[model samples]
Target: MGNILCDGSPIESDPRYRFQGRQWETSMMDAPCNNCKGCFLAMFCPCCFAYHLRVLALEGRMENYSCCQGYLCPTCTSKCIPGQDSCPEFCLCLEVTLCENFAISSTRFYIQDQRQIMTDPCDNRIIRFNNCVQILSFVCHILAIFFRELRHLAHLLDLFADLVYCMVQACMQAQTHHELTLHPTAVDYGQAPRTITQQPTASDKAPLMGHQAPPAYSE
Candidate 1:
């Protein structure tokens, strides 16, 4: 008979281990209202917002976060790219500007992992809705290939779906920024050692008085 208990692997070695974490503090829809600044940045300039979130995830250590840190960098090197040292800010700027979605998603995942925050149900629903819309748009495109009348409608659907998807991404980024504010990392406290100076009072400045010698000893 094969020994079932003889395996030397650790219990956590299983790839199917369930992730345990707390739920998000606020839903994505509510996040924008909760943090107006974050929402404004996300909606107007998503690339900058994504880069800010990446930095926030690393506890404000901008140098630590690089372009495609975990995705492209299989080895997860500290440097932006292996061997050739590159500026983190430049690489991250390029990443967020060119690959905004990937940058935002990666930063979200990184923050979630570090803080052990579970994905909100609203996020799942939005993602599913986006996927369904994309599929429907693709189907519309396919049908338009045969029915020429649907070509304009298909193009419109594609454009609308893409716009919605972009909006959803922006909202999610705003939500992430809000969440970071709610649960700040230790480094956010600004706990660097500081020397405190106190003014000297008259009592403190008084010289130490020696005990008087006995009169008999003086004689």
Candidate 2:
């Protein structure tokens, strides 16, 4: 028995053996590559193109894929008049755009996090990555071969951390400490010195008006 077709007929007996049927023509794999404009449009905005393609596929209508038809619907509903089905399409487009924006923002944050992980030796990210790699190596021993090498690499990284610490310390020491510390004799224009006051001794006190002096006692 030769190859059998889906309709329970031999491939050779089928009239459309070589994809001559409409089914084959409509298939995604058989979609023509002649439309360079469509290709570029899809390439630039795959999400929009995919939504359009999905609509066309489900509706089985070629007219629905017209340029005027927005990504959400098979008609020009840009005005968004009430009682029209355009609201759903507009909401869908908005959702896709928002999701794409969020994905882009998340990717940027992930890239920044990765950069921080690679640059900052103090963080445990490197160690955690190394541990993850070693654990993965259990499933594939090719990584196990580099076990000693990774340890050496970790040591080198620690050395680099020490070097960075020393460099920071040297930089700090090289800076003028005079700028940070106050001079012992420097006058502060912002404030005035407080005057020192002391209580007068009894002998130093002058006699009050109308107050008689005490009689002196003999030693």
Top model by TM-score, which number? 1
The models' CA-based lDDT, in order, is 0.59, 0.28
Q: Residues 70-122, candidate 1, lDDT per residue (tens digit)?
A: 64443553443543234677777777887776677677666654554544545
lDDT value for candidate 2? 0.28
TM-score of each: 0.65, 0.21
Residue 135 shift from truth in candidate 1, angstroms: 3.4
Provide the global lDDT of candidate 1 against the true structure: 0.59
Clashes by residue pair, model 2: none
Instruction: Count backbone overlaps in model 1.
Output: 0
- Position 44, candidate 1: lDDT: 86
lDDT of 2 at 32: 24
Q: Which stretches of candidate 1 lie over 4 Å from their true place?
A: 1-21, 72-85, 142-147, 186-219
- Misplaced by over 4 Å in model 2 are 1-22, 26-32, 54-86, 98-219
